[model samples]
Target: MVGAVHSLGGQEIPLRDPADFLSLVQRGPSYLVREWLFLAYAVFAVGEGVGLYYLTRPARSIALWALVAFSAGILIGIVQDAAVVAFVRQFPSDYAAADAMTRRALEPLARTVVAIIDVQQAVANVLLGVGGALYSVAILRTGVASRWFGLLGVPAAVASVFFGVVTAAAPRLSELQAVAEYAFGLVVLWDLGAAIVMLGFRDDARQDGHANSPRHRGDRPAA
Candidate 1:
């Protein structure tokens, strides 16, 4: 039976068998849900990249390159999701049998699949970093986006680089790999929040400009 264990977080968690932990952590419903969530975000990021490319006409070259890179990155994410699904589906239930099965039937295949995904992910991360850097440059040069938003892009690009490096060095420094993943996730959430804030700020500025214009002054009768 599973038992309750205390974690470093000062929270009690259920301690299950190794097989159960593997299933829950790597191959269970939670992992599946995360994969689907990643797919959804990939869709949003691709759409946003397309919209940015069209809206920022003055930075067309940079926008276009960023679009291409983001699109490639999303494609790689999709492929990785597929591999993860496959791996999870093949995971065995019994720990002892699972080890044997993995070694005999799944390990080699899973390793190869993981290797391909890792390489693709590394390329994707580099492309993502380049795209973010280009976007930041475009934002700064055009003065269309907020400076703070542009600044956030720098760390996002750095995180992308870290992701690529950590992924390539995985299994050796697995702890660092986990940290990199968490850092990337946080950066993405921060970037999304920044975009929302920038949109609001831009709209407010536009409204203020219209209200202050002389054309609007004549529309209002004398007090």
Candidate 2:
């Protein structure tokens, strides 16, 4: 978004104005980079969710739900990013060269994309938040990570959901949006912590595997 603002001479482009938005979109390279960055985020989120699903096996059900919600959210995000690149980005050049009548016809399509983007963003945020919270619960219950690390996700989830709801429902609430945005740093922190622990901490991983094993629960071997 900062890149976008910089591209627009430090002024924010209003989505309500298709002309301004397409003008920004016309900067193809930067636009593609920005969209791809979001795509990368979705991809990484999927990986993290799957890893957590396996690592938090002591709380398998919650982790499964978390993985489901997180994966679903990222899947929608991935589709939305693909839609922007495949569909929305194709319009700027066409719109630029079109006559007044043609431009008017194209505007509705752009607006529809904007509305879909907003809806997808909101649903993604809510699902991710629920997933993150559940994953945190699993982590806490399993002792796979430190308490502080697990607790970090709760506020991050809250902030994400709050920002998503407010942005979709009432974008004019800039103050609340700002607060939520600031709090979203926790999400980054939690992601980093989770990755570090899940990858670097072999003892925790081994313990998780052992804890979930039937033989560890004193089950008899099958004949």
Candidate 3:
């Protein structure tokens, strides 16, 4: 739960420094709260993907792919979150009581865990970007939401994937990783916008021969 730029007092803790990471892990309750929130987000994202697939059913294949991508990302994220939570709960106290030599031995293991988490999170971000892009295309093709709304997601998705790749390729770019964190906000905003459009403008889809916006066009009865 510690950020890319977490500072203890005036000292900024470098990312994945075992000593600092172990120190922060002692704040187990805080870490648990953050991880639980992440879990909640993962659940919400999956539900949202299902709803989007339903709404954009005219683009059935695209929507289905989008849903798959999102769900896959969420699955990886859940595993990553669970790993950190388990590590925090089980290891910090032991690290605290361990002798210097024991701590040295544990540092490599701790760093490996952090590396794994970084890669998992990066892959998750890339998958989320792919999902967002696909879903945006579905929205555009189906006329289920404003074109501008769909357009907004394209660049955001690109930025997300770009930074995600950078993070995975070079985990040392903490600044870019921080930017990557903000990049997700754009995806979140798109989700909020899409929800509002779905709720408030459900009837709008009917204007452009999109009466089947929420249903597959092929399902319509012949006149």
Candidate 4:
């Protein structure tokens, strides 16, 4: 939903100029806010992680912290997103008209800002990889909810680990970095699928409990 809304705001800006990036933000303040939804995404991830922790706690205790670690990475990554917006906000309104010395000064600062974001992303990816790997192993071991989930998780973890290395090693490769983005997307999708499975099957557990309860004793034939 957020991505759809952002696309409506404008097309992509070339990175050759910081001024262009600032102007893009200025042109669509709402879009900038939409992009800030990265924080919201992290918040939801934390909620999901905590719930998963409790759900699998009985048999898969270690997976819980790994899920938490993934959430932690996201929380820290939000700051990097904020820094990006801050840079855009700080850029002068008259950047194009600025003297060469001023433009030169700002360019390096902009590059530095982008580099900071890249490095932070690499760290977050690493944390996510660790979390996904641990959680996948736990799922397979416990078989508490769904084996399909475990199967999905194993590959998801691999993708996370693969992309984490890519991001750390090749931060400047925009095209190659897209694979990392897709890998991250895979992890996100797995979480969504797992949530659905959890919700759908919760009623079965309740039914099983009710069937065995003393309340059902009178309904059954005497043994």
Candidate 5:
């Protein structure tokens, strides 16, 4: 299967036999690394949601709702990643007749797994879209961060919408699924960069200090 995937992409990689799948599970640490990364991002997103909830209070109830939505989105993302990893780990190899038989035996289960992934992906995208819109509005109204951060929301929302459309049309254009996956990865990278910037930078002028920091708000005069 790995060789077939590589051939499709003009690369070469050894295909794991079905019997080797257990060994791959034991030997390969890449899956663990990927899971760690997904968990790390999920934690970061939760932190951001918490921060946003605190920062956007006293004026708009929307921010609080956004925080909840974003947290849910992050949770969904984590689940989706885990599900994908699980699916990969369980995929039967096409190298041997035994593997083919195993795959046939698991076909029903595989379909169920795919269905769950599809549903989770749809939920994640919708939540992300809602969260992005809410965060953009929060930034605009409160001026709690650079408006440039809000620009990130545009692509994020578009990607969410595109993902839904592409996924729905996946059956019609199976070959284009790879392209959709690539596009989604690009958008995720963009979002991760934006999140890092938002969390790291301290643009005092753009921040709603009074709203974000209670102690500082009472101590300093509003600009």
Candidate 6:
């Protein structure tokens, strides 16, 4: 693979032409290889979602379910990016001088892509927002092992849902995607914070000991 690429300095970098890089899937052998690579990536993504479900399952049902919904969104996105986009990008688009038949053939693909984009925005963003919000609520209700789970999770989640709706309608707004990325980033940080908080919790035996300690025993009020 290293030798295949036309890297600079140390090695050769692959695809000297920008067009080759852009239409990589339309090419031959490389396209087949990328398909396998993407399949592997999709598998890894599934594993990650399952791991998340396992960890959050112990929380309230709201959190467990929210995470599941969020994972669905992520999977949809993976399929679109890894499979659908690759397949769709292979179609030729420069139809200005093409005959009527060629132009007619291209229009269907264009419409399909726009439709996919509309669905893609909702599944990839909206569900994430709803799930993140519920997970945060679960954390707050359960008292995360650490202090407050930050003040931004709810806000970010709300933004994520809002962006999802707007993006689905507009579909072509590139800036909206960037905004959703930022909102989703915060949601990710919230999850990390939760994991860290849980990691700091003491073992069951230690918690039992603390409960039975003389200080706590003496401090106990009437039943």
Q: Work out the TM-score per prediction.
A: 0.69, 0.79, 0.77, 0.73, 0.64, 0.54
- Residue 74, candidate 5: Cα error in Å is 1.8
Against the correct fold, how does model 4 do in TM-score? 0.73
TM-score of 2: 0.79
Winner by lDDT:
2
Model 5 segments beyond 4 Å from truth? 1-36, 90-100, 173-179, 182-186, 200-223
Runs off by more than 4 Å, candidate 3: 1-15, 198-223
Report residue 60 deviation for candidate 5 (angstroms): 2.0
Query: Once model 2 is optimally superposed onto the true structure by TM-score, how far is the C-alpha of residue 180 displaced, in angstroms?
Result: 3.5
By TM-score, the best candidate is 2
Model 6 CA deviation exceeding 4 Å by range: 1-58, 92-104, 145-151, 171-182, 191-223
lDDT by residue (tens digit), candidate 3, 1-223: 3332333321121335665756665665555555566667766777677777777778989999998997787788778767766766666777788888998888778777777876887798789789889988998898877899889879767876876686688646755665665666787787787677676655554565575554555574656
Cα lDDT, all candidates: 0.61, 0.74, 0.71, 0.64, 0.59, 0.56
The collision pairs in model 1 are none
Candidate ranking under lDDT, highest first, comes to 2, 3, 4, 1, 5, 6
Question: Which consecutive 10 residues in model 2 have the weakest lDDT in total?
Answer: 6-15
Q: In model 6, how large is the Cα lDDT of residue 62? A: 74
Q: Which model, 1 or 4, shows the larger TM-score? A: 4
- Candidate 1, residues 10-105, lDDT tens digits: the string is 001112334444444443444544545555666667655655555454787887787777678767766766665555444433323565545455
| Worst 10-residue lDDT window, candidate 1 | 1-10
lDDT of 6: 0.56
Predicted candidate 6: what Cα RMSD to the true structure?
A: 9.8
